[model samples]
Target: MDRVHLNPPPAADVAERADAHSVAPLLNCLLREAAAPHGGSRDADGRAPDDGRRVYRLRGSGRLLRVLGERRPAEPEMYVSDAWQRIGHAELVKLVADELRRHTGLSNHELPAEIIDSRNALAALLTARARATAPDDLYLRSEQSLLTGHPFHPAPKARGGGPVATWLPYAPEAHARFPLTLLGLREDTVVEEGDTSALDALGEAPPGYRLLPAHPWQLDLVGRELADAFADGRLVRLGTTGFDTWPTAAIRTLYAPERDLFVKFSLDVRITNDIRRLWRHDLLKLRRTDTATAAALAAIDGPAAWLGDRGYRTADFAFEELAVLVRDGLRGRVLPGATPLLAAGLVEGFEGSPLPGAQDPAAWWEAYLAQVVPPALAAFADHGVVLEAHLQNTLVAVGTDGMPVQALFRDAEGVKLLPDVSRAAGWERLVYCLVVNHLVEIAGALAAHHPTLNPWPAVRRELARHDLPEIPALLSSPTLPGKTNLLLRWTGADGADARYLPLPNPLAG
Candidate 1:
């Protein structure tokens, strides 16, 4: 395996580039929802006025601002001391904090800290990525390639305030691979649901015990909390797995290539919005959600597949704290010979992304929509299973020519059931996840890479082919719901409680 440089650049260059990558997304969110652009002129290319630079006033504070870069804002400059001054990452954080405070009429100290932490994490990732080795498997490289994650989230890279050393080794961005910590739980104390038979193949437990595999990083974070369980004879350490597992974009889920399995653990730390723990409420409903989604996908008439969550196992005493989910790996679920790549990575860009090198941007965009959109819609209309089909939860499998051939969706925990919420509510969630969060990002990336291409007409055509009742309204609606991650975090709302603001709908002709 060839090792890529994961070392920091010259100190000055590292800080400057890292700041641009980190603050761009934060500025994007602020400008989109909370600030108003003014005195902007279009360039000769007509991409955006002033070479994608614009002046704006914060809606709440009415403070003047100037920034370069569109889609993802960069090189932010704030009007201070009667002139436009370039702001570093720290200053950018302060600007966001001030703007958000005035916008919401609420003050939050923690969010600013997280914004700073996220930027710091980006710096570390940039340095480490320069020195890290990309996996030989293109699929794995795509899965691990997200350096600037959730391009719209203010603090997407914050790792619950942990030191860089503690989280860097486990970060997918850092190209990390490590063995799982295996444990044996007394049979009487083992609580499991669904078919967790695959776990038995990882390692054998002594008689009267069941094998449990844990993420080493999670173990370190919660070690002291679990000392009593270890001492009480309920849990016994059985050493780490012989084979190493690679972390995916979602840090807590590990892919074990040897066994062809995915094990999702409950990490008590907050990654983006909520603590990444498999909460007791969600764990209790996992089986039902997974079953519904699995059945829904089974009924879809295309190559789209659902990677079912087979089952979960946890200690009775520490249910949420110790729960581990077993998910179906790619071998059986993914199309044979088709390479599956993370959709998020495709949008974020990786070495093998079909998006950039696409021979026909129109055809490629259409194929992508063909694979990703139909199943998600079918699952909802036919089986009432609302898949969280956002970029991260979706995978686009490409053929030898690097054109999208199939779509595979995962993470049953994020699936929502029908009637549990009104049809109207479910449709809103679907539109936001499928269109706003997933497709729009991909379309933007495609257009940015290939300027002559207009990705939306194809998107409109694809949606028109579908007969869902929501299609008509979706096409004509002037605005689409854009989830307010910055505000959501600032207000300390439940992460699952998605609140969306209206965003101009590109599909509206």
Candidate 2:
């Protein structure tokens, strides 16, 4: 398949010659320059940008260039002298194409006017480049150092599908749930084995902990001791069930014999479909939005207290794998717990209840926003954290009274904060997760139950009257959640006694 890559505006020699101007063209130029080279500097190889691409500032030019992968046109002295042009934007574009040509052995060329002007085309190119450059290798690292929800890390030796393992902390309530930060690991230093004694020579087991190997189908590698103990009767047992995300495996055993608890593992390749199932939900939700980019930008976290209040834990993370873990966990595990909240418990049919999808849209909206939303907003503020508050990622755990009791948030990997930066920025993703993904769901529910809220102009007027936070200003400010959801149920809904209310989206108005 044909793929595209964008280059930043080239050196003065190149930009002085073109006639067009726009951020898109500037980004294209920057990418090209970064792919080039730096003449003389200690950090000359040019570091990749936080978003995973090399951004190069030209030595003598005000323009910049960002290069990704090895697919540039191979003709040297490549300049857009005739058919194309550059744009002037707030972000300075750097140039390092000289370095890129040296690395990829590909020459540069000016894209046709049509390609250069189309935002969708440029975006598609960037996406293709990212995919082409993805490394197929992985390794082990501190889970704490990793982003809250990554699938794998770039390990030096743990590549090409060898024996895998994970030192996951045990959670009694959920299969994949673990402590906020700590995990159990083997005490020995051996990463590989050579002889029969290799099995027996495994690292010393930690006190009150065991090692379970990652059967080919498991998520993380487990400790050996824990696996064996689970086989025998030495470890106390917890319930075992097949995970939808990791269907190829079984929870061989989860034991809590006396001190501390441990989980055992085994795999069945058939389970890989779990990831597909979860991904389907993510894509479905993503497809429902027309303003995804804007929505994502609005959800970044800003404070520690806000994060803590909302039950979020912020820390340095491995960017690439975190989102995978969180997304999968949310759709396949956490949200299912809130099933009873819907009227008649009907997902696809039967619509006679008074909830969001029921007959009282206005009442539902007033009641929901009035009671349920505040707590979630405050919880995040108290902890100084930004959560992926998208609808599919959140759960409104309702009680028997048909009122919301607790807001169960899943996908820990998607949590982020303002004033904090990682390989991936927290702001945009935070917004997308919350407002884009979640707010839309809430709006839909309200529309179904409260039609008055759907009028765009009126809703905007009411929102203004409500004194909602200024989204544009807030986008740049470091902020936190201002309320919390303590899993409390609501009552006084005509005829309904008490039930769990849907947790208000933290990013919504």
List TM-score per model, in order.
0.96, 0.31
Candidate 1 wrongly placed segments (more than 4 Å):
1-3, 6-8, 39-49
In candidate 2, what are the lDDT values of residues 82-123, reduced to their tens digit? 211322321221122333344345434312222232222223
Q: Who wins the TM-score comparison?
A: 1
TM-score of structure candidate 2: 0.31
Cα lDDT of candidate 1 equals: 0.88
- Model 2 stretches astray by more than 4 angstroms: 1-186, 189-216, 219-357, 375-383, 399-406, 421-430, 445-469, 472-509
Candidate whose lDDT is highest: 1
